[model samples]
Target: MRPTLLAVSHGTSDATGASAIAELVALVDRALPDVDVQAAFVDVQQPDAADAVPAIEGPVVIVPLLLSSGFHVHHDLHGIAAKKTDAVVADPLGPDPRLADVLAERLAAVPGDGQPAASTSPVILAVAGSRDPRSLTDAEGMAHLLEQRLGRPIELAYLAARKPDLRTTLTAHPDAPIATYLLARGFFFDLATRLAPGRALTLPLLDNGPVPSALVDLIVDRYEAAEANVI
Candidate 1:
């Protein structure tokens, strides 16, 4: 039997954010019909990993739907996997070039200051910051990928829990567009909108329109790579 793909996320209370994440899981389910795909949350939602992991029958691959490694991935998910017999945790979905492509598309879709964001124009990559140092490193790595993709300088800013917050970054750049580095709409995205008042801000990676193919592929790759070592 195929191992269960336990797609875990940092759950959100926002209805749209919840739906967006569910849709991504559904997309992955369709992509791998033979494998069982289950959704679970680390916080703020039901069917959590603690509950879901024990219920699966076969080997499991726990794939974090988060953008970076942090408290949730290290303490929360790993702790759960450590207790299981044939479960493995996969890497977070970010710090990849495909995500940079999605970020670039989002920037292109929105005009900056009545004009397109120029390739040379400085852009801020706004991430939902974390206190963990590894999370910070991953955020910076993502910024570098996006910078190379956009052919522009990228400034890494946090929404909360870190310095150089979004509001402060906006003040510093004044005219640079903010590329939303979040996976979906949630408290952080709402906070970003409230802070940016009249500025260019791109939508999160997964939006209401449709799930990005890159995201689905990335998740599947994570599961497959980890599944290989599940014995």
Candidate 2:
């Protein structure tokens, strides 16, 4: 029998954020009809990993819908996987070039500020920062990927717990646009928008409904990779 793909995320209380996550899971379910897909969260939502995993009868793969291998991935999800012999955990869904493509697409979709040239409008890749160095590294990797795609430099700013906070970054580049490095709408995304008001161009991670094909593909890839080791 095919193993179930347990797509876990750092849950949010924001209704829009919740809806976005559900849409993402639905997209993954559609992509892999043969394999069962389930959604769980690490916090702030019901049916967390622990509650969701026990119900599955056969092998399971826990794919974190997170951008980095931070506390939730290492401790929360790992703790859940440890209790199940047939389960394996997959890495977070970011630091991928495809995500950069999504960022670029979001940037392009936003109405231009009537700037003479794209090069004139700088970008700040705003993320919910982590104290973990590895997490920071992953965010930096994403910034680099986005920079390559946009053919310009992108500054990395955090919503919390890191240097170069959003306000500071915005102050530094008054006219720059903020490309949110977030998966869905939440407190951080809201804060980013408030920080830059008119200049912040937000991208809905999974919440845009009808989930992006690229994101679905990435989630499936992670599930398949973990499933391969489910023995």
Candidate 3:
């Protein structure tokens, strides 16, 4: 039997957040119709990896729907995979050049009055900050890739737990747009928007609508990488 793809996320209570994750999983399922794709969470939701892993009958791949390698990836998902012999954990979805393409697309497509032009105004990459050094490094790596793709400098800011908060970044630039480094819409993105208000143009990640093609490809790539070790 083909390995079952277990897509896990840091769950959220927000309806929009839940739906966005579901949609992304659905896209993965649709892309590979023969494969079984399941959704689980690390927290704040049901059917976490601990519960979901035991129920699966064959080889499994746990792909974290996270932007960076944080506690959830290092501790939670790794802990769950350690208990199961047939399960393999995939890397988090960030620090990839394809994601930089996604961020550039989002920045270019931002509509309305305050949208910043790629050639002129500065862009800030805003992420849900982490205390983990790996997570911070991953975010910076992504920022570097995005900067290369856009042919401009991209500043890094955090919504929490890091230096140069969104407000400070905004205050300094005063006219730059914030390219959200989030996987979905939730409290973090909400707080980011509120911080800058009208002054910053915030772009959505995967929530509130359809999943992007680049993200879908990235998900498939991670799953394939893990599946290679299934035997």
Query: Between 1 and 2, whose TM-score is larger?
Result: 1
**Top TM-score hit:** 1
Winning model by lDDT: 1
What would the per-residue lDDT of candidate 1 be over residues 1-231, giving only the tens digit for each residue? 889999999999999999999999999999999999999999999998999998888799999999998999999999999889899999999899999999988988886433644757789999998999999999999999988887789988899899899888888999898999999999899999999987889999987888999999999999998998897
**Residue-level lDDT tens digits of model 3 in 1-231:** 679999999888889888988888999999988899999998989897789998999889999999999899999998998888989999999999998887877776666423445475678899999888999999989999998898777888899989989888888887677899988877887788788777545566774766888888999999998889875
RMSD of each: 1.3, 1.6, 1.9
TM-score-sorted candidate list, best first: 1, 2, 3
The segments of candidate 2 whose C-alpha lies over 4 angstroms from its true place after superposition are: 207-209
User: Global CA lDDT of candidate 1, please?
Assistant: 0.92
Instruction: Give the alpha carbon lDDT tens digit for every residue of 1-231 in model 2.
Output: 789999998888899888888888988998999988999988899887889998889999999999886788887888888898999899899899999998887777677643666675678889898887889889989999999888877999899999899889888988777788889988888887777777747566654556778999999999888888997
Error of 3 at 127 (Å): 0.6
